[model samples]
Target: MSEPAAEAAAPAADNKKKKWLMIGLIGGGVLLIVLSVVLAVVLSHGKSKKGQSKAHDTEQQAEEGDAEGGGEEHADAEEHGKKEEGHEKPKAEHGSAEPEHTTETHKPAEGGKPGDEAALKAEADQLKQDIAKLQHEMDQQTEMLTLSDEAAKLKSEINALKEKKASLEGDKQKLAEGVKQIRSGEKKCAISGNPDKRLDELRACLGMSQHGESKPGEHKPAGDSHEVHWSYNGENGPEFWAKLKPEWKVCAEGRTQSPINLVGKFGSGVPALSYEYKSSALTVVNNGHTIQANVAEGGGVVLDGKRYKLLQFHFHTPSEEQINGRANDMVAHLVHKSEDGKLLVIGVLLNRGKDNPVLKPVFDNMPGKASEEKAVPNAGFDANRLLPASRNYFHYDGSLTTPPCSEGVKWFVLKNVGNISPKQYDAYTQLYPYNARPVQAVNGRAIVEN
Candidate 1:
């Protein structure tokens, strides 16, 4: 009995040990398969994360490079603007994040060993989550880089606009200064009251001065030297001369003015002039109105048994006096005054023909500006050279031809005509196109012609 029992017990125990061993081996193989699957999943997730990190780095680098290029382009533009404005360029302040991207780099994790299946599976899932987080961060960085680039572009545009505005302001300031200078010059002209003379003086101050001239009235007191502005045209012209000053009222209201037409019957017993003229230094002046010459104190003429001293002579284009309703090229008025302040004028008609030898010195040295006087020191001018060989003339009672237009003046117009070169006529006309006053009414005055 004991032998049988022992044999059976030993066989059963061996069978049980073999079954337990098989179960242990099978369990180990299943655990290995699960660990391998977890390892594969972890490796795939790591590779995916690494690839994403590399792509993000490449994108970030590209964006950084673009930002750098944009910055460089903006700097060039700023430099060009600075050169145009004649100043130094200012620094840019916006979109300065390129340095942060350059310093950062993504690195993958080291290799790992397989462990329990559940533990490995959990580790792979955690790795996947980490990779997703990193990818999200890279996407955010890329967006930030894009925004930075846009900001940089906007900043560059703003700087360019600022520079343009500054340039415009500078131009405006220059224009303002020029206007101020012009206004100041106009003020000085207003103070002088003699627009032509003041304008010449202003031109001199501005480096554009010209010179040639005459004195209209020299016998007046120094305090009465204020110029009565008048011209041949515009508001201050001859038509308005009567309203310019109280002394010039006769220009518009008085009758018996000089420069009357010598039409109708000629009266008899015309006076012959007796001239006693001396050689003296010649002085020429260009008044605003015409060219004039001043004579020395000794020259005098006797007409109708009365003595009148020759004071000055002036010229007018298209002669002021009309002989029988016809006009000449020019006329010379030799103004004379008697001891009692009576005025007398000798009118000489001029025609364009041969040059007059007597007028060479005065014409050659004509002044260029108003009120300018030039004295010919070494050259002596004879008053008798102005007269023709015959003393026959037409005599009449008239008024002064100038602004005062005072009546009771004696006029003597020579019968013989004077000749002047076409060049001399043109030279005088160039300075004064038309200075002759309009012919006054005869007013029943008698003209005596010899």
Candidate 2:
């Protein structure tokens, strides 16, 4: 054997052994660092006594580092001697030295690398992040729902405000129209000429009340003319005339009424009617109930030797008195009054025939409005012209036919019918189509013929 070479090989073998031991000590330190990290993770979990598996894993790592030896150290130690090889190999097996190959298998024990428990930790952290994100999204959705409810409420309020604004505008327009009407009415009333003595401007303007109604404290003429307002048909018809005024109760309660059926049975001794009629100015007026013509004081008639002066004459289409239970086309009532305040009416029945010139002016100037009196200055309406040729008549004691029917009045309805044009009949019917009282019962009154 060569002594120098042998000495040099011995130092080389010693250097190799020292190098392997240094690597093993460094690996043990790294394994200890890994154990600390694993234990810290277990403690941080705060699990119960179930953390014993990590301690078992630590003992397994220690045994593996002892059994799976490193390279080059075992080959040099075997060549030296059989006895020395056994002792040195036991030194290598004592877990003081480790191989680079075993270090790679233990890399899973590092903090950031993928290992057994490290993979589970990374997944748990990822789940926590995902849950936090989901919670944040749910919070956002809840906030959006709350905001939507508020928006809907605000919209409803806005709609209500618009409707109120429209209602106010409509009221404003109506008020403006009322104001305009009042101003126009005041301007027209200013010039109607209120009389210095009389306070009513409407009546002073010749009964031409444009409004058809008088104001409070305004005076209206009292009579059957303007006191009680009535018409032929409606609530104010002849049926309700008695109910209109308390003083007109005789119209409904009187035993003897006018306009009885003129069918007679025999002839009693009665004086004939003597008429003293003359031409007079024809003055006509519509008293709302009928067309009445006022005659001057000259006209009159003599019944039973008693003198009666003609006051006025009114007309009725479809004669008020029924002849044989049938009515003619029209009738002219000659109303006369005696000096002693007694009244007697002569009802002359008229049928459609030739035109009589006597009543031409009376129907021609028929007033349209009530209480408006008009005069035909040159119209000479003779009362005798309205009488039928035969003075034979049915006479009875009755009352005034209209409201306020005062009893004890004398009535003479002529038997012979007079002729009037159909045009004249239509002219009167236009103003008063029907204005007659129904035929009343003849309560045992003697109907005598002249």
lDDT of 1 at 2: 97
Cand. 1 Cα-lDDT = 0.67
My TM-score estimates for the predictions, one after another, are: 0.50, 0.51
lDDT of each: 0.67, 0.66
**Alpha-carbon RMSD of each model:** 30.0, 27.8
Clash totals in order: 10, 0
TM-score of 2: 0.51
lDDT of 2 by residue, 1-450 (tens): 599999989999999999998887788757854654564454433322233222212211222233455542232111111122123322323333333211111122234333446668889999999999999999999999999988876775564354344434433453455446557774233333535633344233333332334221122212222356544555556678689889877777888988888775855977677889988887686655678887765479987788998878887767889978999888888888877788899898889999978888887899765555577778887877777677888888998877667788889988898888889888888877877777888888888886
Off by over 4 Å in 2: 1-226
